[model samples]
Target chain A: MTPAEDYELPAGPGRNDNWQGVTPRQAFMRGMAVALTVPGIILFASAAGYGALARDAGFSLGNSVFMMGVFFALPAQVVLLDQIARGGSLMAGTLAVTLTGMRLLPMSVLLMPLLKGKRATRWRYLVAGHFIAVTAWMEGWRRLPLVPSELRMDHFIGIGTGLVLATLAGTWAGFELAGSVPHVVEAVLLLLTPIYFLLSLIASASGEADRLAIVLGGFLGPPLYVAFPGFDLLLAGIIGGSIARFVVRSRGTG
Target chain B: MTSSLHEVTQAAGAASGTLPTGLTLALILTVISLATHEPWRWLGLILGRNIDVDSELFRWVRAVSTALVAALVTRLVVFPAGALGGVPLLVRVLAMLCGLGVYLLFGRRISFGVVTAAVVLVAGQSIMGP
Candidate 1:
């Protein structure tokens, strides 16, 4: 076997639950099935909320659909929609979206190494990287250790595709239902995005760094938004994350 | 002449649509992913995987990602935009706490927590009448 393939194999005895004998088709199916679970549901709800908000902000249904398919990230899409609705210039909107997307940088860096096995070509990695949003990143982080390296990319792509399709459908549905839906129901739908994150933050935390960052960021986010409304998310994340990392490192846990 | 000029400017402003902005934002999101993700993966490939995965730099990268997402989530909760902002501050915080309580109590199943929070918000608004 090639060195890369050997490296891709899981160390020691493999878990019976790991995708040892699974084919690529099975891996993709596994990914798609995961989308029906909590992670996929949260993404769908958020995208639907984005769609409703976009429609309310005067975007055409097509535009709302396009945003979900293209931008994909809800926070960035929210910024873009809000800015456009408020009559901001294109340059300002673009900058805001780009800043929100900066969060993806770390996600990309983390997922890149995990996805690269013997079968990964340069193009394959790049394409797979497109699918590495919060849900994909967290799921991959949790699941990649168990997957055969050859199936990692396939599994990721399947989940990513499922996530994309879910978001798109949710957006379209929200756009359609925006006005007709009751205010309370609408409120519930819209609130799901934040609630999902909060719960995920508390539940998905796996390490000291994660817990510290979440606490620091949650504490700092409000004040920072009031102080620097435009760049608040970016500022809070960088500052809070840096502090958490430093603390972890100093304590020898990093 | 001044009245005519004002009318023309108003019409021009109304005619400007969000098409350009949507396309531009989409392009920017795509580019950000490509620029940030592609370079690192390629570098890892060239230099060998051990250095890339085991290094201190990658750890910091992950730490920052978690922080950013957490911060953004908090921002949405504390300083929500659009319709969510209409709910009173107390109500928002209480609802969030309710959801969080459920999340912790129920083994962190995200849907259960989110549902609890949403239910609280809707129920609170109904009882409180806003």
Candidate 2:
């Protein structure tokens, strides 16, 4: 088995006891601290950019900030804003945003198992589902394998909550700073979000298949977007992913 | 739904002289997104309980999502939007390289790369005066 495969196996007796002294709350707090390092900064930058964009588009500050909380998916939120700014119909805006968010469905499904706990309530699952954006999902997937199952939920929640709160704060900051900040600085701040997501996604990629998918998608997206415009995202994902999967499986590397 | 939101935004615009387009629609979209996400997990619970977490299908889903995100990121970088469109292409590509370099050199920590990219962009733009 690959090193990555070995990493996913549950720790044996003494290994699991490494966290013996750490309380669940402590574990949760530690997770939050780690989250604030990378994911929080990314989310903050992205949300700040989104806020600035919304402000430029004439969205009320309240609405902009509220959107951060309501539609935690940054891409979908941006799509909603873009559609609205273009004077698209409400249904068109809603459908576009919803379709953009369809990617989150699989993420939510993948996360559900990692979050299993003896005492986990249905409500916890429901609420946690809302927070399962790319950041939370990627972070949780990386960290949860070694975490004791009991503390998994706490860790996930801690990271997720930190990201959510950071997004909120960033949105407000971006909105308020849009006017006073130099255009260069504002643009750089906006760039941070996508850069962070791309790097994290690539850096934490599991194996060759994922790497291949990233390459294919990166190359294919621009031309596809120019050709199909609205459908580029979905088509590139499905096509690139399938091609990557086939390559990996055919090579017998997976 | 479209007509109602149009009327609402139009009425609000007429009163305030500013478009409050899709406020209600945004709310509706959020509700729909949240509501739609739940059923997938429930389906997973019913069907995926016995299946391996990293099953082939799960891998495919992850791959597809990752590809989608990659595509979106690429689009944002290449085509850009709004103010970003004004920045020179070379600076953007160079900033991305600087960030990627930092990401690899700094034990693959994400913050280092992300911060490096942002700093590079700001510094590059300031120096170039564009």
For residues A116-183, write the lDDT of model 1, one tens digit per residue: 77768877776676675667767776667678888888888888888889999999988787768776
Taking all chains together, the TM-score of candidate 1 against the true structure is 0.74
The numbered model that scores best in TM-score is 2
Give the Å shift of residue A77 in candidate 2. 3.0
Predicted candidate 2 versus true structure: per-residue lDDT over A1-254, tens digit per residue? 01122222233455433666677787678667754564567678878888877776667788888888877778777656644554445464555454445556555656777888864677767667667776777767777777888888777777778788889999999888876887787678667656876786675477888889888988888898778755676778889888998899899898
Instruction: Report how far off residue B80 is in candidate 1 (Å).
Output: 2.6
* Docking quality band of candidate 2, CAPRI definitions: acceptable
Candidate 1: which docking quality band?
Answer: acceptable
How many residue pairs in model 2 have overlapping backbones? 0
Q: Judged by DockQ, which candidate is best?
A: 2
User: Which clashing pairs does model 2 show?
Assistant: none
lDDT of 1 by residue, B28-90 (tens): 545643444334434443444345444566556555656666776776666654456667667
